[model samples]
Target: MTVKTAEDRLHDVAIIGGGVVGCAMFRACVLAGARTVLLEKGGDLLEGASKANSAILHTGFDATPDTLEVTCMQRGYALYRDICENMNLSVMKTGAMVAAWSADDIACFPAIMDKAARNGVPVKQLDAQQARLREPALSKDVRGAVLVEEEHLIDPWSAPLAYARQAVENGGTHLCRARVESGVREGNVWRLDVAGKPAVRARVVINCAGNHGDLVEAIARPSPFTITPRKGQFVVFDKTASDLFRTIILPVPTALTKGVVVTRTVFGNVLVGPTAEPQTEREFPTVEHDALEKLREAAFRIIPALRDHDVTTAYAGLRPATQFSDYQIEALPTDGWITVGGIRSTGLTGALGIAEHVVGLYRAHFADPSPLANVVVPSMPNLVEERPRPWMQPERGPIVCHCERVTEHEIEAALTDRVLPAGTLGGLRRRTRCMMGRCQGFYCTRRVMELAQSHLPGLVSPTGKGRSDV
Candidate 1:
């Protein structure tokens, strides 16, 4: 019989959350030669704000001038290609446009372009005729627009999954369903307790707990900031609307929201809405009919042709808004805990730079670090519309999920993939795009679950909290 250790070994750093930021922190620590461990309360990954996020890779053109968001967003945008290429994540370089439906919106173009320049993003100004010629689906009343040439659409869930996979393969540890209820420092080490699991001890603790970041910080020490949940609801149109545009159609941003946008996903589906409304219930991801109508109106005003397409699905995402506008990342004096909070909407675009920032804080805490060589990047199976299906090439087994073109081989890989196995339908969807198409898995859910049960026994149940343990 194999001997199991009585307790887990102490790590150099123990990150509290498994969201994008936390996974990025874990990857950074591993790259910087730190023995890091990531603890997520969920059974899988991306359970919070990261789950329902719009898949747009922002250009930070409209970020508030001279803040951490602008700096990190700029870096993230620039680093996007290199990172995605190494990890095999699909990214659509289909640029973006901020459409002006009114004279006021038209007047804001010059200022918007100026702000884009300040954020180190180049944008082009287009007149109404010029805009109409580019996208015939756009509304006839569009006066003018500002084109952000670098804005791209990416696979939103892939980055976190890839980062976590890299960290684990590179000697970092990941604990799913390991929630850190409390942490206390004894001498030079911080001990963290997880429900129904061994206590994880570390010399440094970093909190990347998304919307519950404040709660995670309170577990170790008092929180310096409060995270107010801001809900943004969105509607996705079927891939039949792919011709609507090859780029993102943005609106004049307000102080609080990015306004609703009609943008293409990497898989060719068009997404609309993301109506920003402040809410306190993090558990409720309910979509409002009124908000759905408002988002539809917004999409229709920009692209009238969008009205002809069927609404595939609608969902909501929460952003961690705080009293301060910029991100709150600081090392606390009490114990070795650093808080990463208030990342809001830009978290997806800024994931890499935020990792660097947290790594710098990690170095500041321990003071000794060594330069590490290039970490191996794992190649992911492409799920983009353009990529040929497994059945198209090899004689893979019968197709399982017809809605998204997911095949049996692909489903098996998702079920047994070493990086992050799919234990739930949601997790499987994120991995293989199963059950997310127009039919919404009505045709394939049962067949897929049957495959899951055969390949990944005891792990394929659909649940309210998803597959993640936290």
Candidate 2:
């Protein structure tokens, strides 16, 4: 429960942004034996682009070969598997299938297979009959598919939370609502002006800002890339729809986007869509009714059985996409800054690997600190439906959210977490899966507010009577 303050001490590395990548960076830098600090602009971590995603742990089978993206993805995928069990994270190995519905899509199979082979990923060619045998719910019109064996699903929230928690437990500073407004380097040390806080001194600054990456990069030097936020909208069906499919259903790859995908989430619900539409808006990614309708139509076309199930909710996430197809990771030795940008859909899988690569960059260009001899590894609460939940145990407290079966004990634990407790309602939801089920927050908001009102700031109950609602 010890919280480190970034007061007068100079940090070896200061990471900007609190997205998944930033959390991973903080963990990497701290474990590398650096005095690290992470400054976030939001009320909680993952308030930006990392908050919403498909949660697919990609195998990089379709990534461009010999590229940084592929390398980072493969390494991240490996690192996640190595630490998942220790951190109590969950990985559902429900392999993916590139289902082809038309002759043109089937024609692209050879190139796809060649790319997978080049990337050293194992894939199988499944004929229509074979594909349907694996997933009987698949449409009979499916011509063929390429089965990607290593592609899987993961708890996107818990993975990053574990990373940040470990870093904080092992002597790292995590400051929320501390946005970096400007920076100036003097004698190999950078002095950063964080909004509403005293100046921070760091030997090196790493910008992991998701949507505001280019803007952060501009503070160091003229940014080489321009961030054009690409919006991806998705639909989540009720848990009953999870029975409609086993394998993740993917569409044929196009130049612009990955197209819509139909897959089951780790929380035992079916998911679909994520239409890649580019827009100028940076902060909020609003879900349009038309876009959501189109996504539902697309999902129905992919899995007709889904028509019988009700949709729980729909959401949209903004990706920090640049003009370049590959990741934009480079160390600016002269400016004492490093920029990690253009990480779009694969960020969840690439975050750990990206951390390793950035650590290498810091060692090669900046100071090479000794690695921590005793690294503290923290385990996260099991939010994955496949794992044992808190409510399943005998000593568990009363349930707060019946839809998700979230227990009062789990909510309290999340609210009082020592290293990084839930600072906002959204953070609490992500931490304990509370208010995220079919009923959303209708059944549990009052109880949750009662438990969290004192711990969280500016949190009021449904009764609009200030804090008296508690």
Candidate 3:
């Protein structure tokens, strides 16, 4: 596909950032029969925090009762469940358990249960024996746990891709590397000066820039809230260790943190850690050696068997923490803009609900409701054909990564996806797990880079310059 220029005319809505929240907002705008444009600073969609998340479909159990975040999470969970069923995306309904390790921790269960009930999440308190019966891998010292049956794991890669795919299918335009330098509101519309390109006009602008939310808000001048980057690092264990727990094991939350967790990813890997630490926006937010050690210690305390599992990978993600505890979703009626800020850790679970809410805000403020005709929900392409994975398809039968069983077909499909730019081996690895095996790209990095260079344009091949290093 050839690269296209930005549109000069005004759109119904222009969403800044191509992360999950932005993608969801774009889809919702399109579904409401509004012309929408999504601006992404990165080379492709999901290049930000959206792609590097814990990938849990939260049950609103941890959210404060009856708050906007909690309500949105619950609604978004249902919406995502429907979308997953319709799109054929990988979704695992593995329940989550909030384990207590001490008497004080055990005493907190009632309040947690009350919060869950207030949030409309069905949770049952289980004693250590019962908890062990449910998940035998849990440490015997577990005092008790609250079972959140509705909680599940989702494929992090597919969620944003599906949203972007559907948005494009619904005639929404997505522009990559089109960073919004600044914006000025003139009359009823906002004109955005996009990175050396022609200014694009829109009736409404929605800021869903994740970590860059504050930056984008500054461009609009006089921000309502500032965004802080809260970093969390995690480790992925080999799929052979997926049996470490039948359910997601979570530690009781403190005022500051949700603590460490051991959960099964939708991709079939067992994951642990995600220590929350505050960091500057300029930093890339990565795993610290000390943090990893602490995570391992906590993981072993929760489930001793995890210590025996071989780690496949380790990475970090930055959450866009804001001043407010609840979501800072508001419309700048005076500025003809809307800001979805302070999403934090629960953004993934609340994405769709937030999108829907943003759409209503547009209608209420702009007073222009287009015909809802031709409402279309795009079908997602099937990425996983079957289980025991290798024997599912001819391509899967050939192992590209000895540890992950990632196939050539999967990598090829991810590379060819128009919305994703798998130009580098690292990008491909993020998209398809091509080099995210136990060896951590030690064995297949060269081959993967070669394939990426051949498949993606403007990427440097291993043999050197094909396109300008510029």
Candidate 4:
């Protein structure tokens, strides 16, 4: 397939950033029957904060009432329920809890309930005995918990991919590895200059550039906030530890962080930590030794059984924290651009809401709007953790990646994934769960690489088989 140059296409909308928010906006724009083109600086989708999240689908329980964050969360949660059903996305409806150990923490529940009420999130206050009965592994020191029954868990990798895939199938374009260096408004249109590709001309440009939103906005218009990368580290325990908690076990909020959380993932693994440390380096997300000790101590108090479980992996991600508490979204009518910045965390939970909000901004400026004649939802490859494996099928081919129960047939589908611009091993792992299990590719590294080499031509095989790189 020959890729078209920017000159060959004048998109109705060009969206910068291919993270969850950007993908969401792309899908929304396409659904509105616009010619949308998504440009990502990264090699693949969900490579930033979107990938390394805690996968908690927050229900706006703690957000400030009437704020854009809470409103988006309230709306996004409903949109997610529908999208998950139609697209067959894996969503584990395990409710969330804010566990309180200290007296001060317990005192905060009333205010938490007040906030939940304002946001329309139905929450209940639980006593110590009820909390303990619900999650037996919790510390005896725990006084009570605030439960948000609609809160849930999902696989971190798929929602954006699903949206982007649906967008592509609906006539949107995905321009991977295309970083917008600068953009300018020519008359009524915006000319976005990419790093290597031809300059893309669009009627309007939507900036959803995550951490680089500051830079993208500075290119054409004034940005409201400066993005600072706050590094967070986490530990993933194997599925053997999943039984410890039926819900997302969260600690009371602190001044700096949301506090450590111990939650079971949709993939059946138990996730803990996510110690927030504001840092300068966005690229280097190394888990600090002291941070790990702090997280371990927090875990020991939150769940004593954490000591018995073995850690499958430990990694880090940087949040695009900004000076503002609420999200900064503005319609740059003068520049034919829209800036979406300061969406630090919960981008996954509020992605579609943000998209709808941005599209409204775009429509206010771009006249003669076109609506889709028919809507189509694309079906993604089966990546649900609880679902049956391809190997379970009669006479299926060889089995690979035993730790994840991935079969050769599933891997072949990933190698030829129709949605991806480049069928990378990392993408394959996200799509088919090939090398992301407990061993961390220790056992299936060579075989997966060999399979990729045999299937995908000229694809450079990854070394060490680690999550990030060689």
Candidate 5:
């Protein structure tokens, strides 16, 4: 609960953007015993592309071999496993099936397996019959599949919060509604001009702004690379349809894309679609009517039975992609500045690895060569067990959302949690399951909004009073 003064001007490192990468970097800095400041323009954390992703934990099974991305993903998967276990976060290792429907796709499987092996990912090829037995929902035309036992599904919302919470507990400052307008290096320190706030002086600044990475880099004039926002749209199927698949079913990759896939979320809901299309950074993800139809057609082709399942929601997320296929993490000549770009789709799975890499860069390039002391930061209690949903904790059993089985108590906790503050009802619904049901907040919006307003007063009116309805 310690808040730094606007004019205080103190921090070892300042991270712009509060997305998964930025939050992860903040956590890494904290763990490395560096005083860090995490700045976000959104009212709460994970409000950007991070919260709306497909939430699949990639295993680098198809990533280009011997690349920085592949290396990071492999290390990240192990790190995530440790963090998930320690924090009691929701993550399901349901495995993954990369199925081939045609001769060309089948031919590509061996190459993919080779690539995975080079990336140090364990994968085994399965015959068509074996694939069908593993995932009966798959189409009969399937030629074969590569079973990646390590790839998993995670609750995207919880993962970043876990990192942010751990960072805050470790004395890192997480400031929301604080946007960095521009920054520059003056002597040994980097001074940041935060929107509507006083300037902050820090020894180093890490650019982890996701879509706005280029803009942040532009603030200092020249940058190594530019970022382009690649949009991916997805459809969420009802939890009742969860039985359609036991593992994440993926389509063989083409030269341009990874194709569409079906997967079961940790919340027991089935997910489909994730059509990647190039788009503007200002444009938030939304399902195009054509995209939705294309997704349905592709999904039906993979699992004909999926055509019968009810789709609960459709959304999109923007991926910060660069011209390079591999990740770009390097220090700038202008003292105390680093850029983390080209995260692409593997970002979620590779976040921790990226953080660790950035920390090493700080030690090697930015910080002095003096040996740093290891500081032990206390971790937050696991909320997954203590505040389970009504269905999970039957004593509090009246379901508010029949489709998702979200409850009132869960909504209350989401609105009140310190680390992942739910400023709006939609935000609360994202954090908890309160209003993300088939009704789509029709039944619970009012109550959830009321609770959110009560818990986060200023947040309910992010634009002051004029746009109170937001």
Candidate 6:
């Protein structure tokens, strides 16, 4: 069978990014009976700002009321819960608490409660004693907290991957390493000039180009926003530290960010993170020593027991922030373009809802699309620790990665996935959790390289020699 690449065929909708929002947009457009093609500049999906996140599914409890961000978040939250089970995804129901550490934070409680009520998210106030009763691991400095019962944790990688898979399985095209360099509108169609590939023609172009949103948007019209990349650093604690807390510990919100959060990931590791700092680089977010140290200290402050545990790793991610606070989603019918930019931390939770909104825009301005009959929904492999791992199953192959318990079969499947195969080492790690463990692939690198020799190119061997692509 011949694999499909981005051809000269005129697609109905063309998405410019492969982040969570772009993946979700592809899914929605395909389901709505539109011929869609997603162009990702990276080797695989989620290579942009969507790559690293806290992975918390927000409830919009403290979101700015009556804003597009909150509206999309609530709708996306519902849509995710609705489709998770069908897609074989998991959600760890570790609710969150906005712990007040100071008198100023406590003073913000009334406004927080009012905002939650206005946003229609149910949240109850908990006194310091009551908060401590619920979470015995909290520090003595905790004054009060607002219990957000619906906030939860999810696999940040798997959800978007599932969306992309579902779209591909339902007849949508995904072209990786296909960067949109320039575009021009010809009558009713837009011809996008992709780097090294043939120009792709589409009737509608949605700019979901996360970090490069401004540059991409300028191709259609004068960009209404400027993308100032905000770097967020995080520290991951060992899985043993996960036992110290059952709830997501959040700090009071400020004008800049939601503040630092200490939460347990679905993979059974305690995560402390996300120091927001502004930067100009669109890619390559590096973790600084000072930021990591501060995050570690903050984690220790929140859960004193974390100091006893080991630090697994430290990483950083960038978010596409703009001068405005709310999301920038608008339809420019004159140019046959739509801009979905300035989606910062809430993009994960707001993806599906934003997709829905974009579809509405497409229908109103572009063309009337009939919903597809019997759409396909792909079932992703179970990655959440609560679910049964592949290594624990019958007929499981040899365990290649002992720390993450990734089996040889799992790696093979990820490498050869029919819809969206892992194109790079980072993609493979996200798909199988193979190199994201205690050892971080120290022991399994050679075997993984051997398995990927035929599929991936330019991979250096464990002995510092490059393997010829099969």
Off by over 4 Å in 2: 1-5, 467-470
Candidate 5 structure quality by residue, lDDT tens digits, 33-61: 88889998887777776777778888787
What is the TM-score of candidate 6?
0.98
In model 3, pairs of residues that clash are none
Candidate 2, 413: how far from true, in Å? 0.8
Per-candidate TM-scores read 0.94, 0.97, 0.93, 0.94, 0.92, 0.98
Worst-scoring 10-residue span by lDDT in model 5: 377-386
lDDT of each: 0.81, 0.92, 0.79, 0.82, 0.77, 0.92
lDDT of 2 at 60: 97
lDDT, model 3: 0.79
- Which residues of candidate 3, in runs, are more than 4 Å off? 1-5, 371-376, 381-391, 395-399, 418-427, 454-458, 464-470
Span of ten consecutive residues with least summed lDDT in model 2: 461-470
Off by over 4 Å in 5: 1-7, 368-402, 457-470
Estimate the TM-score for candidate 1.
Answer: 0.94
Question: Candidate 4, TM-score vs. the true structure?
Answer: 0.94
Pairs that collide in candidate 5 are: none
Instruction: Give me the runs in candidate 4 sitting further than 4 Å from their true place.
Output: 1-7, 454-470
Model 1, span 216-256: residue lDDT tens: 88877678889889998999998999977797888898888
